[model samples]
Target: MYNNASVNKVFLMGYVAREPRIHNSKNGKPQLSFSLTTTESIKTQGGDIQHSEVHAIKINADAACLKDVNLKKGDMLYVQGRLQTHAFVDEQLIKRYKTEIVAIGVELFDPIQL
Candidate 1:
């Protein structure tokens, strides 16, 4: 028996829901976080249905990547990264879990016309 499989990648293309929240990490690394919304329509027994999914993205990149690009709400983007899950305890001492896309690359598209 032979096993050879290794892949951890995610690709998403969607519109930015809001402006990115920029901040610095403890080690002084630049970080950008934003919400992306992807929508799709599916055929079901009832009828055609529209569905939308929002993904939280966090980008840890160099200063150039975060400073040179002007990111804004409603901007279309293509992101490639890996999925990451974080577990922490809230103020109430309850455990919480969150899944987010840790973006390695981001490409900004032209503004979407309505």
Candidate 2:
């Protein structure tokens, strides 16, 4: 039995940390992956400090999103999607996991200057 009682959603507004890489999945579907960086300034006991966090984003647009917009490094964007985690084993027999936002929609803010 399943009930629609929960949701998995994420929203991020940050700058692109690197150029988007487009690839094809095993099923031959197009996929896009990129890194995004978000920064924030927090007031601490000592003073205000700035902190930056980087996130790995995976867009399943399958080339449709890139048809019109040109995305590049350092460009500001707003990403909306759901959070997904992938787990794997390392060479040393250690378990590792990574969480990424599976972008369903992306909006470009500041376009990169040529």
Candidate 3:
């Protein structure tokens, strides 16, 4: 093990916190927003347990990629993207910052069977 270059990339696997929000930008690019919950492995003398955290993500796709496929709420998806931080001023004129996963690729997983 060694401490080296700054590590900023992450590969995440989790369940969707909510339904995907599909929208179009003013320039007509297809975009979506959703949250994912990921679990971490917890270990101790007793055994192992999984801890989870919910993350917010944004997915941007080309118009052609969004055709015919109907994405709905509560859909299971896999997202590969980069970590991004957004800083903005709210209505109160106070500066605010938030971090989110900006997706470059999205894949839908099979639905959960009953």
Q: Which candidate number maximizes TM-score?
A: 2
Sorted by TM-score (best first), the order is 2, 1, 3
Q: Can you write out model 3's per-residue Cα lDDT over 1-114, one digit (the tens) per residue? A: 467756566567667878777788557777777788877899989999888888888767553445565666566666677898989999999999989987766666775742
- lDDT to native, each model: 0.86, 0.86, 0.74
Model 3 TM-score, 2 decimals: 0.66
In candidate 1, which residue pairs get closer than 3 Å at backbone N, Cα or C atoms, i.e. clash?
none
Error of 2 at 3 (Å): 7.7
Off by over 4 Å in 3: 1-8, 24-28, 61-69, 90-94, 111-114
At residue 95, candidate 2 shows an lDDT of 98
lDDT of candidate 1 vs native? 0.86
TM-scores of all models?
0.84, 0.86, 0.66
> Which lDDT tens digits does candidate 1 get at residues 83-102?
98989999999999999999
Over 1-114, each residue of candidate 2 has an lDDT whose tens digit, in order, gives 557688999889999999998888668777889999999999999999999999999886554655688888988999888999989999999999999988888988854532
Tell me how far the alpha carbon of residue 109 in candidate 2 is from the true structure, in angstroms, after superposition: 0.5
How far off is residue 73 in model 1, in Å?
0.6
